[model samples]
Target: MTAYEAPALVISECQQGLLDPPPGAFSGLAAQAAGRGLIERTAELARAFRSRSLPVVHCTIVHRADQKGMLPNSYLGKMAIEERMMVEGTRDVQIPAELGPEPTDLVSSRATGLTAFYGTDLDAMLRLQRVRTLVVAGISTNVALPGLALEAVNRGYDVVLAEDCTAGTTAEDHRYMVDNLLAMLTRITPAADVIGRLPG
Candidate 1:
């Protein structure tokens, strides 16, 4: 399949809580991404992809009040408990306003764990849409992005990392994850490159 055939723009954990964290709760990488305008750039890419009739999937994290689906004894669970993040019906878990996932956008919200693919229908939904290539964007490249990319590659889907559209806990960490790890698994390009390649 061609690079652009049935591509899905998969955004991971671009949630309000993480992107715009409460005072003193923000991570350096997230701040860096915001400072570098990753969120705005990603929003533009999402809109461009949507305008081209491409699939736009937003993978978010939202836990129940009881946190039944949340994995315990883990960093994610610890953070959830400490920060009180991603509670069901809470505004913290909502997608950022700028990205603005429309009614037509596919949303995959999971409370289980970090990876968007695990215990989620994201893979199946992409297949249903006949997606051969995935233009991946969003936050925490150190965790979710790599997990998603690995799973996508294992599932035989071509993966492309939207470099300017994602971030980690630190700029160096993000760069290392993307350049040293994810880059080997998937083609890493700027959001503009990915957007420009879309079929008109």
Candidate 2:
């Protein structure tokens, strides 16, 4: 079988809040990385995946204003209280404009912490679609990308980390995670390679 036949792309936390950080938000090295055009690269990959009729799954973080779905005292709650981000029904929680999801795309959202599979049914959804390979990308490579990669492996899915499509708080942080921890679990490849392998 072709490498991409049973593949599904999972984009985690590529929301407006991260792509376009609000004033005084966590716009550190990660923001600088995104500013360097990671978002555009990711969007292009998403478009390519859709063109091949592959499943494009967007995993986001959405929480209520009253913290109804939040894990109390968790990092998510602290970020929500501090950065004031990802509140449900707000622009912060929406995926950015660049990688706009089509009506046929699958959107998985959680109200709590990192790892899209935790409070979401992303694994089951992908399995239901007969997806055995996962192409993962998105914000904070130090956080969500690695977390989701491990989870996908535990659930018996082969994962490919989109090296160019992910960003972290710093260049070192991004490189270290992919080269160290994540590299041990999945193949760290450029998005271009993955896209090129898809059938026309």
Candidate 3:
């Protein structure tokens, strides 16, 4: 595929939830992505994109805007009183060291929605690179995954969620989001399929 045709991979936040925290298929918020297996899965995807010289983007949520701007009018909004939970310069919100590509492998967010582009420069960055397709894999599908899928669809991009490369806060939310996207926004491809496409 040409650079224009090369698919880009995006890994959204697999960080610890403010309340639930990351769990190990194992336990704990310390390794949200690591615990769910996405950490390793995404590493492989990242390696492939890197080897192929494809554009790879990382997104994290750290509500820099007001609650109304970030969340709906509900308890969840009230709960997330602080902004910048995963801001660029925060000690509590660093990407796992196990994941690679160096410090250069991060894109900071100033809002708290699924689509990192909601209030950030994500779309601009991807647009600048002429990326029209996206492969998203991460934790919290119900939140980030859906948000990304919706946003990508609205922006006219082909979005694929790498199943198994991501997991949600709950089985129902995960299933629902995937099903919802499949019905309307995007497609869900298994991680194995994505891995097989790597330039091995």
Quick one: best TM-score, which candidate? Answer: 1
What C-alpha RMSD separates each model from the true structure?
1.8, 1.9, 4.4
* Comparing 2 and 3 on TM-score, the stronger one: 2
The C-alpha local distance difference test score for the whole of candidate 1 amounts to 0.85
Q: Please name the candidate that would achieve the greatest lDDT relative to the true structure.
A: 1
lDDT of each: 0.85, 0.82, 0.64
The residue pairs found clashing in candidate 2 are none
Over 51-96, each residue of candidate 3 has an lDDT whose tens digit, in order, gives: 7777777776665533446554544444455432344354434556
Could you tell me which 10 consecutive residues in candidate 1 have the lowest summed lDDT? 21-30
Off by over 4 Å in 3: 1-4, 16-35, 64-72, 82-89, 101-106, 112-114, 198-200
Candidate 2 per-residue lDDT, tens place, 135-180, comes to 9888777778888988889999999888888888878787788789
- The TM-scores of all predictions, comma-separated, are 0.94, 0.92, 0.76
Misplaced by over 4 Å in model 1 are 1-3
Residues forming the 10-long window of minimal summed lDDT in candidate 2: 68-77
TM-score of 3: 0.76
